[model samples]
Target: MVIRLAIVFVLTFVSCQEENDIAAKNILGIGRMQAVAVSGRLICNGRPATNVKLKLYENEILFDRLMEESRTDSNGQFRVSGSKREISRIDPKLNIYHKCNYNGLCYKKFTIKIPKDYINNGREADRTYDIGTLNLANQYPGQSTDCIN
Candidate 1:
């Protein structure tokens, strides 16, 4: 009877350890790294808009909060990362600051809405969502745009 009791205790300990391991992975994002990867090229007119400031924001009802930021490289390419928990709550947006003009109209800042489904939400391990190329141009007459900055 003592031997059977010992075996049962060991099995319980092992089961708890397994559960703790999974919980740790989920909380620390060990196996779920790279929850959201936003990468794209910033183009203004016909040339690469290099050295532009890019900011990531979570669009909420009351206000939009900035999460991460990155600058465009020499080729106007940028990449930014965010956690699943922060991005899953609200819609993500990419804000760009540049001096782009079209037909005598210029915009110093612009925003791009990121699709909600693009975020992994920690369900998939090592997932990356490519937002593709972002072509930023000045607004024409009667053209609607979202600018914050």
Candidate 2:
């Protein structure tokens, strides 16, 4: 009985400590609004890759939060902007979904990280990260396959 009581006490203490840590993070600006924006062009085999899906996201600890989503225009250009309230500096990234070279059922996925300097502390981003033209035919370093964006 005494050992069981000790175990219960230890578990309670650990849980309370975790809660305190969360509270401390909140107090340190966990929910302040931040924003970011990105724009770029997509090309495949020297031609415009039109109608390609793109998404902007705030990378979180457990799950990523989508900020904005759009598709490439007929000219293969796209722009995405998003804002979120976060505990720390928002980790912004752009996810591109396309079928550049693969004939598989799933689309090719690529991620481009926006530098921390571009993360603005406001409802709207002050500046946009220009990701110049990216040739999708050339395999990227950390590319993956995704059926869902």
For this target, which candidate reaches the highest TM-score against the unseen true structure?
Answer: 2
Clash totals for all candidate models = 0, 2
> Candidate 1, clashing residue pairs?
none
- On the 0 to 100 scale, the lDDT of residue 91 in model 1 is 70
Candidate 1 residues 49-145, lDDT tens each? 7888878876755556566788999888888765534313447777777766534344466667776567654533244456666667745334343
Model 2 lDDT tens row, 1-149: 99999999877755554346446556885578789999989999999999999989988765677789999999899989998776678899999999998899999998999999999988899999999999999989799999876
Local distance difference test, candidate 2: 0.87
TM-score of candidate 2 versus the correct structure, residues matched by position: 0.79
Candidate of highest lDDT: 2
Per-candidate Cα lDDT values, in order, are 0.64, 0.87
Off by over 4 Å in 2: 1-30
Query: What TM-score, to 2 decimals, does candidate 1 have?
Result: 0.57
